[model samples]
Target: MEITMYDKLLQLPLFQGLCQEDFTSILEKVRFEFNKYPAGSCIAQQGKACKQLIFILQGTVYAKSIDNEHGYVLYETFDSPQVIEPYSLFGMFPQYTASYHAQTDISTVSFNKSYVLSELNKYEIFQLNYLNVISNRAQNVYRKLWDTHIGNTAEKITNFLQLRCTKPAGEKTLQIKMEDLATLIDDTRINVSKVLNKFQEEGLIQLKRKEIHIPALEKLIEQYT
Candidate 1:
């Protein structure tokens, strides 16, 4: 691997805190596959078995999750240097929760589950990094359960998005009827529309027929919360 690429890989959460020697040792022992995807190409599908650990090395990836029971689809875009659901590699359901597609021409580095257990897991730093990532995710979700109450309509809507999204900073799209969204947030349709229109006017979001497009979720959250 090129020194530049190695440096980029070191920035990833799973590889952080590792010395150059350990990093090089793991690389020499494990076979890491590098792949490129064009824009609009499907990287992974929801419910597919996650047999490998895929780390986005370049470009952007869009993730979409459909809640058939809830009658909505959530879309989120992730930039490079992000892992695609590392926790999904283990557990009873070992499957991706959302479908992912390349938003732009992208490159990725991946290794199978067998390599993860037999090679990566043997490193103490790797184990600690992996554990911290999973633990932090769990704690964030748990904390959201207690943060359900928001008096302001905008804050409530922002909270709803933050709770559903896997990452707080990203481009997000919520495909649902205004009425359905209002119902979910326990607000009147008129009131929800009013606040959304205000948001659109302030350049926070774009309101379309049955869709709400947030250019930047972090900015939206900051504005409202």
Candidate 2:
């Protein structure tokens, strides 16, 4: 049988572990609105009141943080059938910490904060999973904070490399721009460029305009990490 959008939603972190019966009930009981955004469109802006819990149903979203000196910093990206800023929906002052833009044509279903919270209280498994999601998000932010404030330039660059390095088409590489890296890591473009050059000279990485191919990611990681 072909999987439905409802089935895909059950696979998400927030909705995982829910049986079909319960999932159906929640869908019928809760109120949500679907929204579509074209490619390169802004889904949500930073510091805006987060009144709804948005779940992406299609395409990709690129999240960015505003930097006073460096402009917008690319923080992360998320793909379809996933939640966006669940943590921001709660707390004393709820606001999106980063702006999200559609990387491609995207669709989302959003649940009002009051309704989602009501469901959370009614469902134990959903509540636990929601806590897990928020906890994991918090941990990531904490780690990023440690890396940015405490780690040195070399550490920062290496950490960035470790986090972003991926093997696509069986080739190990990081297809990222130097300027984007600088902005993401809150480092100067010159410093980021210099470190990448040093890594290249040391036979650690091969640099292209927007791609950094690591000969052996383990070796590169071991040197600094």
**Candidate number with greatest lDDT:** 1
Clashes of each: 0, 0
User: Each candidate's root-mean-square deviation in Å?
Assistant: 1.4, 5.7
TM-score of 2: 0.71
> What are the models' TM-scores?
0.95, 0.71
Model 1 TM-score, 2 decimals: 0.95
Clashes of 2: 0
Q: Which pairs clash in model 2? A: none
Give the alpha carbon lDDT tens digit for every residue of 47-81 in model 1.
99999999999999999998888799999999888
